[model samples]
Target chain A: MNVVGRRTLTVIALVALAIVGALTAEWWLSQSPDRPFGHTQAGHVLGWAGLLLMLLVLAYPFRKRHTPGQRWSKSLFQVHIVGGLVGHLLILLHAGAHLHALIPVLAMLAMGLVVVSGIVGQVLHALAFRTMNEQRRLLLHQGLPEPEVEARLQALAKQEETFRLWQVIHGPLTVTFVALAMLHIGGALYYGGF
Target chain B: MTWPPPFSMYPVLLTATLVLIIGLGWASARDPESFWAPGDLSVHHAGRMSCTQCHEPFRGATTANCIACHADATFISQPDSPPQIFHRQAARERARCLTCHTEHRGTTARITTDPLNPHSEFIFRVTGTQSCRDCHAGVQKPGPKYGLLNNDAVRRLVAKGKGAHGPGRFADCFRCHAGGRTGAERGS
Candidate 1:
């Protein structure tokens, strides 16, 4: 019906899907002859899927840049977040507890850092937006005109959004992940990986 | 002031990414087995730095690689030859090298020796199944196996066990005295 209702529904749906997916993965792993560790076929599939998802997540920045000032950019951002979360889950599943290789372990660590920093960025941005909205509502209630209220909100948003250090963390971590992943892939191939 | 545009650092990140990828490729190309290998290759292949010797580009080392090296009469002539026989068996069975010999294990020990069999660690080398307690005192108690037998003591232990157990009595020593079944079967 409304934006809040739509957003709430979307979040609930995503959570439900994630829970179901996790349960299904757990069941599949249980039935497998081997644990779904990275060495197993299922684990390899998950790792590949996770890498693909990371590629999608990496594409988001380009998507946003190319589609600047477009409404679809917001949807793309949401996709990026979902893709990143799913990718992280797949990777964690693939790794399980037995992270043995050096390059792959480093890649997993970089992926972890990227995912954590991304979540931090999301939380910080949400907090800033909420605070700005609350301040705007307060200004509006005090009988300020819409234009001045908007200006005040923008100023508050500017101040709060300045703490975008998450970008510094997120971007470099992504780069590191990509680099390590490449190294892992290259190493695997050189060592006779099919 | 506002933060710099997110894209501002793109050049740096790109450069770093390129540098790391290139650096890895350069190092790995020269010595892939030791560079990023999980474990050291078996002693048989340990001296080899080039992964390309066994592994094909992207497809990895197939039985073909083994065949390439050991398929000739030189390897086949010796029935008891461990490496050549293993390669021949693999070829007959159409087995992948990875089934028995996985790489990048971070240590060459895995390729050289079996982890499951404890007797492999002993340097004295028992000819047959013998009481482990002959060397490893107090190992028969219900706990972890005793530490490795001392090199000097190994010779003495082997001689003593051989003399005491002879061949028939010690046949099932591994069945009881080996780590898993407990020490109840010792000195039978």
Candidate 2:
């Protein structure tokens, strides 16, 4: 067996398994009963862990830049996509499909915004990735040097279909996520605060 | 062989125990995990040393008695239960503080606190929130035509329209319509 290939697969597997673990914890703990301070706190912790994982998925480019030492990383994109989707699933389990009507409705709006943007981001990101892949294939056919190919991929990453639209949506998306997050926190404070 | 009750009675016994559990929780004033969370309405003041201790009956719950407990003269005991908040409510309708201030009943305060509880009995007719969609169905979206979308969120959204952008009136219909005096304060 190719140890390096196996290790790459192992990393992806671990990330996916962690997502499932978070989801399981979320489900188990939400059913445990909600209290000001109780076992359900574990569920809150897991939910946030899932969100952090999703954010890592969002920050795919930064990771690639920083980790130049590991070139044969074997497609972190797949891991990123799978990890982000798993977080969404786990988040659902954490909330336990029950919430006060007002705050939950507002929360649903924020989540829906995230889901829509994520879908758009995924499609554009996929399309751009595919195009880049095709360009690399064509260059190989034309006998382009490895350096030239690497330069091309870097250039494309800077500006492409998904990244271009992302430039517009990325900031608003951040603002909305952060703003709605503050509102979510405010609601928690209002409900559970002194 | 029989140390206790029969097995056949288990279902009935379980139901009885559950009802007892809820009753105890209710009496004790705490949240319940017994699947009936909302049904758990602990009395706000059942252990009150006396209604008269806190509630000063006026020339039969006169406004003075309201001010007595509701004002700063007495360090307001329960922040949630304030009179001036409802004083203007009582004053505008020429209503006695005792009207909504019925003290003996358990969880009577729920009329104000519980959003689903109806306000039909009160002179303050409208549910502090909305009353229409109580049953009429599907009036909420494509955005409440005559103005049901005026809930707090919508109102804040509309406030945004008003503050930064010029007026359009459609941003938050819920603030005005759901609020008391349909077209008065929030209709702006």
Candidate 3:
């Protein structure tokens, strides 16, 4: 109904999608243990595709930092969010509940954490932004002077600072995921001969 | 004022991530086998922890390493044996042994892929045939291609009737044709 409600629903939908993807993978593996899809050529292709999407998602942060005023910033952020979730789903399919090595297992865990934190960060950012805009609109309606309105928004800005703190967790998890994923890729190349 | 407080789990999650990273790094550096091994080695190869025994550093496991120990002639000579036939065909094509014989799947896990059950494609690829009858057309009679039929006990089974020797029923050929046993002993 409202902004926060919509944001909460978005978070729930993302989490539900992730759970469904995981369950589907488990079901597929259980049905065909003798011929695991993860061992197939298609599986490797999916893994690479997912990894590429994840790498592309990093462009959003780079663009935001280097050129915040870019016309395509909003579109790039949308791509980042959608690409990240789809990439993670593809990877979950590629893995197919077949991971046995510690490196891959750790990488998957880190990736999961990164996705979870990213979703939380997205919701928090949207809430903070919308709340500020709503407050500013109400202040203008109340006929507050422009300077006074600006002064009041500064207090809300401190609350926004707290919301941005999700980045502290999200950023580190992403770094950990990247490090572990690189190691996994190295191991696959060295031992898998591909 | 802040409408909502910051996530309470932020500090806990950050600490967990740091611990995971540090712990994994230390384990990987100190004991790579524990950190990198896909799973426990099969019982036949359990004693050899050195990956280099079967694997080349960057090229993965090579057929040369597999043949170094399994260079027995019977693997090629025994056409009646489905596994041996599959292996012979795979070797002829220079297929990597790892394609079908993956290791590090627990001590008692079946390492070799079951061709008849799971990988009928191997047979089709090698013989251009899909069914057992396509290759074993003369399975009822003694012949060069199906030498195991020459055994008297097997011949007797053939005489028993069509019910016992129906298609797809002989999937477990190894139940009788146990490795290292003579054809007579195998059929008995």
Winning model by TM-score: 3
Binned by DockQ into CAPRI classes (incorrect, acceptable, medium, high), candidate 3 is acceptable
Give the TM-score (0 to 1) of chain B in model 2.
0.27
DockQ of each: 0.23, 0.02, 0.27
Q: How does model 2 score on DockQ?
A: 0.02
Q: Predictions ranked by TM-score, top down?
A: 3, 1, 2
lDDT (10s digit) by residue, model 3, range B1-188: 22122588668767987897788778776766666777778767887556666777677778888888777465766655455676677777888776667777666445666444332333233335544544444343333335233444445445543454444444433343333122423234
Q: Ten residues in a row with the worst lDDT in model 1 chain A?
A: A30-39
**Cα error of candidate 3 at position B158, Å:** 16
Candidate 3: misplaced stretches above 4 Å? A1-3, A6-10, A26-35, A68-72, A144-159, B1-31, B72-95, B114-188
What TM-score against the true fold does each predicted structure earn? Answer: 0.62, 0.37, 0.69
Q: Is candidate 2 or candidate 3 better by TM-score?
A: 3
Query: How many clashing pairs does model 1 include?
Result: 8
Which of the two candidates, 1 or 3, achieves a greater DockQ against the reference? Answer: 3
Off by over 4 Å in 2: A1-46, A55-79, A96-104, A149-159, B1-188
True contacts kept of each: 0.43, 0.00, 0.46
Ten contiguous residues with the weakest lDDT in model 2 chain A: A30-39
Candidate order, DockQ descending? 3, 1, 2
